[model samples]
Target: MKHLILCCLLLCACVAAHAHKPSDSYLNLVVEGQSVTGQWDIALRDLDFAIGLDANGDAAITWGEVRARQSEIDAYAMARLQLQAGGKSCPAAVTEHLIDDHTDGAYVVLRFRALCADTVSELQARYALFFDIDPQHKGLLQLMYQGQSSTAIFSPDKATQQFKLTQPSRIRQFVDYGREGVWHIWIGFDHILFLLALLLPAVVVRREQTWQAVDAFKPALWSVLKIVTAFTLAHSITLTLATLGVISLPSRWVESTIAASVVVAALNNIYPLFRERRWVMAFLFGLIHGFGFASVLTDLGLPKSALVLALVGFNLGVETGQMAIVAVFLPLAFYLRRTTLYRRAILLGGSILIAILAAGWLVERVFDMKFLPF
Candidate 1:
């Protein structure tokens, strides 16, 4: 146990020893007629984006023209947008982001308007800006003339130009879910943590729960299977509800509560909390994580036609990720079970790490700052 704990810390230390890699974001813009919508896939790559307004709003605007309009827009518009790189989480991604607006798909505030001034509506197009994808970004847009909120998803073909929404709007024909579903499954940090917490108990065999809990340390894979199955089934149920708009929760509260669940799960690990029916815990916590999944679809604005498909795809991505983790951990835990040291080290060290992470998250969310020094 002691050696494994040391090894884990040493591994983390070595990784942290290197400069942390920056996060990249890719935003896909779909401007249908007059309504403009943005979808992004947050990643480790620098952000690339395009303001794909399908309108000929302008004839042409030079850098000078765009720079000049900046002030006019600031003065006349009720809202102002400040361009920040990366996302809301990081403030100084300035050097990392290489922003350009002179591309074929780039939208120039004045140039586009100038080019299309003669017409009532002209589609101004700008695509392929390599930048970060931030969902809560609003300042970039000042006022939407007839912007309608809708959801979008990438076509399975992956060749379609645009996507459609769950609820058909009065004006919008197609919506853009873009790569957000895959993106969330990939970068949703909270979802990852919840899975990790639930995963911990599965890796070990409680001496109390099994007659062979400590045998060659290969107690039984059945426990892990049961837990994973329960989690998958439970979350899938709510993921649908949350996505379909049948239910909802305050984002902050849901997120905070998830962190809290991790703490509880970790505590249980040190001294079995859900001793009888782990499924109950799985079902309850899985519901919360499912809501986290729903938020991604909710943000995209589900399409009535694509709801089932979107749900299936996103859930599949999640299960794939979850199953991948199990595949990695199960073998390691199985091997370690042979040694007395393995069980102690894994439970103690794993529990501590989970608790620390969950507690840090709790402080970060509840108090807006870290309660403990890093």
Candidate 2:
């Protein structure tokens, strides 16, 4: 019992910490012969935190402020990124500075050119942006060489990476995207909460206006299987379509709807709608969640040559992560299904808390404002 309580507390802490999307920057490099040209998009919010983008303390950043600090921004970013070709350094210089808007917020765009000492067959890069302050920061890199595209993600643990410009590895791309899919699902708090909301009542059935624990675990496991299957099928459809550019939706709409789905799922647990057919709800809302997942892949820019392999790997990774969550949750929930603490506190109280938090997310995403501290 004490362990469960501690676990719940730790979960709440993680939810608070990740209430907002973690920081990420996009980098695209084009390699031709001995020349390298690239663009880096760094979030202004991150830069402001790192090097005071806002000249005044008004809590608002403007183009004037950004232009005034352009030199400092260039220096800060350039110092963190290094490029090398064929075991020789390729010194780079900023060609242009601009601003752009991403789904998250405004970003500073740096366009640069690097001249290699020899014809480039292999390229190496070292990226350390925001790693000192925000360890979770990631650099999404897209490399284009000889009409072929490859992608890689840079993290604090793996900040420096080498790429073979001659031919990108299909196996490496599959593994990288698969790993990213698992990481995204694990950190995706809203998705986790939505799944938990559906699972909360699986071990119990409502009878005579009250909840009663099931006599055996088989029924609960079956219920979970249905819900998970429904969600998996629904999201996989949209994730593939959206990533393939067959369908597209605005990021704001997708994010707001996803939050709304979480709210509805959690509220249904407290209100007991669709009690016997929860899989239906999962299927319906899981479509919207798929779009949310697509945003990550779309940003990564899939390689056209090995697109299917990468997609399959990522989808499998998502399923693996989802099943792991179920493995941990189902046994613990079944063990305590008949307990008053599980019935009252975990199911009811936890649902209420999830609903409230998701409601906050819905409002913030819809209004384009930040009300929560995170």
How many clashes in each structure?
Answer: 48, 0
Residue-wise lDDT of candidate 1 within 1-374, one digit each (tens)?
Answer: 65566446422321222111112222333433433333333221121122222223453334444444444432322121111112211111111112243111233221111111122132222222222243322111111223433332322233122223223442322222323444454455545545555555554556745312435434346666777888888888988887877897876677677778777876776777686356677778888878767765554444455456656766776777677666766666555555545455455565677677777777666654434432
lDDT of model 1 at residue 198? 55
TM-score of each: 0.57, 0.95
Q: What are the lDDT scores of the predictions, listed in order? A: 0.47, 0.88
lDDT of 2 by residue, 1-374 (tens): 67577447424623553553568899999999899999999999899999998788887899999999999999999999999987899999999999998877899999999999998988999999999999988999999998999999999999999988877888888998998888778778888888988998999999988778999999999999999999999999999999898999999999999889988988887788898899999999999989988887777778899989889888888888899889888888888888887788788888888888899899999998876866
- lDDT at 317 for candidate 1? 66
Candidate 1 has an lDDT of: 0.47
* Model 2 TM-score (2 dp): 0.95
Best candidate per lDDT, number?
Answer: 2
